[model samples]
Target: MYKQLLITGGAGFIGSNFVAHWLAQHPHTQVTILDLLTYAGNMANLQSVADNPNLSFVRGDIGDKALVSSLFAEKDFDCVVHFAAESHVDRSIEEPDIFLKTNVLGTHNLLECAKQHWLYPGAKPRTHLFHHVSTDEVFGSLQPGESPFTEENNYKPNSPYSASKAASDHLVRAYHNTYQLNTSICHCCNAFGPHQHTEKLIPKTIHAILSNKTIPVYGDGLQIRDWMYVHHTVEAIERIITKGEKGEAYNVGYNQEKTNMTLIGETCSLMDKLFADNTQLQRQFPEATKAAEGKSKELISHVEDRLGHDRRYAINANKLSAHLNFSQTGSFEENLLDTIRWFIQQHTKVSTIDI
Candidate 1:
């Protein structure tokens, strides 16, 4: 379908990747991106698709009803993939009002606009979709060895971030029930890949190691999380938007669970190998001696833990797999290695550009 899709927060990690993936796969589709370009939203991440004729980027807040309405009127977006939000749990703890405004109110604005524009008495097709991207944190931390979160899991959001997302999810469901707006909610696990902002755990650890800075581990670092590559998450979202039932929710994950310490150690080991190989090569060339020569793991530094941090977040993606016949590439380890290599390459490129 050559549809006009509006992707909010398209400059953010997964959103940017989704936009790129969708454009590449569906060459006929056109995408308009609305992002406020917050701290986590990096325009540089979308540089690869910046010049694509099928893509348009607009910097604006989702809370701006007039702006959103104008876009709806002008672009006549057939489908909306809503990813804009304040996503960090720690940051949400510090400033919840921002989360409420962006995540809850922002979603409300989008729903209202869509309802007004696409839900008229005699609207065409009468099935425009508003896909809400969410997190598995809404289900709270699971007990040790318990089954993963499923579509039927109760909402037990603990942090400001999850609460905001839960509120948004409720709004989407309410719109579907009350106004008959077509919507689907997708709750995904922790995502890691290229162009991810450095504030997240994996990217932060990689950046710290590359810069020879201390890697901070919270608590005993035993917190478990289900990890999925960004590309896989994008694929899940596309599948949901195209094939999902209205007012339904799906969990997208790799089913690869690992503790924080284990994740950090794996990243450190990868960095160690890359740095060691480079250091040995430097020995043959005196000019390369200035390059950093040491194990990146020496930078490990444990710090205070986050308050009310979820101990574990697992997802049961049976609904996604059985219904949509969706299956991930099953390359978590390989994908992680490739991600580390990308981070190292990006660090080197940034350093070169800075000099």
Candidate 2:
């Protein structure tokens, strides 16, 4: 076990969850979180573990070479779980330069720092690990009814976000091959869970429905995505970092493929259920009445399709299962229902955010 672990981008939804999960599993381990706290990196996501004795937080950009190097030198982290990047595809379309800098250059800086600190001459074997968290977007879109993406899939990134991630993945591989740095990579499918920013599809839909705003469905809402629960992905990352083979890339997914339309409909149905229950409560107690039990589905609004939007994305998790003894714990339907309940509970909190 590593004495000191550094998790970059630890304030974001996935990173924050990973931190909370890691600390709970390893009480003796010390963790340092470095995050830039961009729009998506919410501090509230980490409030649950804020008071934990084993965790520490740092606010800074990953592209800052001096800051990253200083942290590596000072802390001498034995493992790095890198989750920081400009992740939203829509945002990347609007701003590609920011993606290149933060995702590509920022990763390069961290790799160099790790090389200098952990790859010194005669270093202990497998004493350090630099685990990069990436996405399946790097493989671009799959044809209709095609097989899922695997490690051997060719890189055909269509968006700036994915291209930047591909570049970082290459750099990580290069460092491992040339300098013998212990590195691993896991490309995951779309993730949804609590603490996710409103920019994402599920959260955005929830926010729109709750506030009586239009739920924008890009194009025909036929684009397919393999949705994985956030906790499941985090668990895969933990397993890979601890037990995966260095220099290997693993694909983590829930194998739960759903089109945008199907997902939106499911979300609307759950919201309706919650609203009906609330209405019943109001009837029982007249003073408890708040707002009318309005139908959330009325908010659906079709919008122009995004540029270069992939038609589908799927992942084959055979390697992850074979090597790490891992598999998804729940079906997409089960997880989606749980997610809907969570959103219903958080309606007030999400309503305040600008959709």
Candidate 3:
């Protein structure tokens, strides 16, 4: 239980969710968030917890070494949960330098600051931690029958995004081995939940359906991803931070693999049910009456595939499960419904105000 913690990227999807979760579960912990407020980072996501006495929001870049060092010196953070990075693969493909800067150099900056603050000459490693949140794409795409990614899998990142993440992962391991920085890394599969940016697949699909627009599917939309809800992802991270061995990496997943098309279909089915019965939409967005018509399936639009898109990504979580005794409690469908409801409620609120 870290009393004073720094959470980088706390305004983004997973980061913001983790902040809310942490404050709720550990009310005594003080959290300071460092975010650049990039397009993906939205302050609206943290509205529910804006008044949290244990939370402080700072708008800054992790690459700013001076700022990070100052924060570490002032707050004396015992732990750092790094979630700040340029995460979108398509954006990375267009401009890879930002990804390298934020994902690699930004991570390096934080590691250096943490090392200076937490490490001292001729001292055993302290209880302080630097927890790195990463993605399974660092293992590259898995074939149909190939085994899921384990911690031992060779680094074969397929995109600028994944490669940048791979570099950061290596840096974390290097710091642990060479400098003994007392770090732990967890690589998760695709995450879906509330407050996710709409540019992402699940949220974008939901947005298209609700707005009577075409829902674009890249290629055949059969790309497989192990879907972990944001809450479960946070739980896994907490477990790793609390009990995981130093210098080790864990693959965090629930073994729930769903293809792009299947996920879209499930989301559309749920939306149809919600739109038909939602009183908020009837009162606020009568224009959304067509959503209840169940034509969301007709909105499916197959577009060009993502460049160098990985066909499948799965994680072998036997290690995480056996070692930590952790298990995911909710089914994908249950969580997906919960996520869809949140988005609808959010959209309805916005639409109501617009009218």
- Highest-lDDT candidate: 3
Give me the runs in candidate 1 sitting further than 4 Å from their true place: 280-294, 350-355
Q: Residue 42 of model 3: what lDDT?
A: 94
Q: Residue 216 of candidate 1: its Cα lDDT?
A: 95
Q: Tens digits of per-residue lDDT for model 2 on 1-355?
A: 8779989999998999899999998899999999999998988889899999889999999889899889988887999999999998899999999999999999999999899888777776558999999999999999987999999999999999999999999999999999889999999999999888888999988767656678899999999999999999899999999899999999998788989999998888776665565654233323211223545666788999999999999999999999889976777767776776576556544443221
Candidate 2's C-alpha runs over 4 A off are 122-126, 280-294, 349-355
lDDT (Cα, 0-100) at 320 in candidate 1: 98
Q: What is the lDDT for 113 in model 2?
A: 89
Better of 2 and 3 by lDDT: 3
Q: How would you encode candidate 1's per-residue C-alpha lDDT over 243-341 as one tens digit per residue?
A: 898889999988899999999888877666655666543333233222244455567778999989899999999999999889977577788988987
lDDT of 3 by residue, 13-61 (tens): 9999999988888999999999999998999999989999889988999
Q: At residue 215, what lDDT does model 1 achieve?
A: 84
Which candidate, 1 or 3, has the higher TM-score? 3
Better of 1 and 2 by lDDT: 1
Worst 10 residues of 3 by lDDT: 346-355
**What's the lDDT for all of these models?**
0.87, 0.87, 0.90
Q: Where does the lowest 10-residue lDDT sum fall in candidate 1?
A: 282-291
On the 0 to 100 scale, the lDDT of residue 65 in model 3 is 89
How accurate locally is residue 290 in candidate 1, as Cα lDDT from 0 to 100? 21
Better-scoring candidate (TM-score), 2 or 3: 3
* Residue 76 error, candidate 3, Å: 0.6
RMSD of each: 3.1, 3.7, 2.3
